[model samples]
Target: MDKRSLTQLTERFRESEKRTEILRQELAAAIRQAAADDVPQKDICEATGYTRQQIRRIVLAGETETAAQP
Candidate 1:
């Protein structure tokens, strides 16, 4: 592709990735709530397709980001 076309494609892909991260964060928040409600870690990992450690990090990161917001 030409430079102009490549630039446009790159911008579109970046925007799509941003949108996807929004969904991912939302999912993390929901998973955090589920865990708080006594859901097992292994069950959460199985349902969310994230490993146990990844789930912990996601929940912690989500909490940190939310706490940082006004």
Candidate 2:
């Protein structure tokens, strides 16, 4: 590809990556909130298509964050 085309493609890829990261953080936050609110983990997994272990990790991370707060 030409230099201009390559630069445009690179910009698009960067934007896409940023969006992917934002969505991932948002999803993780949502999952953590639901778990904190006593929503069933299995239901969250089924709805979000994530494994139980992954959900557990996310919940644990949130717990750790709260414990560290002043």
Candidate 3:
């Protein structure tokens, strides 16, 4: 309701958006690196601090990309 509160909320939202973008880029790079290196999902997970399931999903997505290429 107050101007100060509104400003704080806007700042927090901006920070969250920036963090999300950084994480997205990091995830994409990790996926690409994993695909290029032919690393195992578990190793990717360990290196990237992602869970096994997340690593699997990323690797599978990379596989689909490779499959789609001519």
Candidate 4:
């Protein structure tokens, strides 16, 4: 492949990674909000298609980051 094409592909891949990170943060925030609103863990798991452990970790991680943000 031409260097120009390869560079463009690399840039697109990097953009995709950035978007993925933003979505992950949004998902974590949504999960934390749902938990605060008294949503059940099972309901969260079902809605998010994540295991209970995964949902718990996301919520805990979000809380930790929020607490550290001043």
- What are the clashing pairs of model 4? none
Models 1 onward score TM values of 0.73, 0.89, 0.56, 0.89
What is candidate 4's CA lDDT for residue 70? 69
Give the Cα RMSD of candidate 3: 3.1
lDDT (Cα, tens digit) per residue for candidate 1, span 1-70 = 8999999999999999999999987898899899779899999988988898898997788788889999
Model 1 sits at a Cα RMSD from the real structure of 2.5
What is the lDDT of every predicted structure here?
Answer: 0.89, 0.94, 0.81, 0.94
lDDT of 1: 0.89
lDDT of 4 by residue, 1-70 (tens): 9999999999999999999999988998999999999999999999999999999898898888889996
| lDDT of prediction 4 | 0.94
Q: Please rank every candidate by TM-score, starting with the best.
A: 2, 4, 1, 3
* Model 1 ranges off by over 4 Å: 62-70
- For residues 1-70, write the lDDT of model 2, one tens digit per residue: 9999999999999999999999998999999989878999889999999999999998898888989999
Per-residue lDDT over 1-70 for candidate 3, one digit per residue giving the tens place of the 0 to 100 score = 9999999999999999999999996787777786688887767777778788777777678778879999
Model 4, residue 35: distance off in Å is 0.6
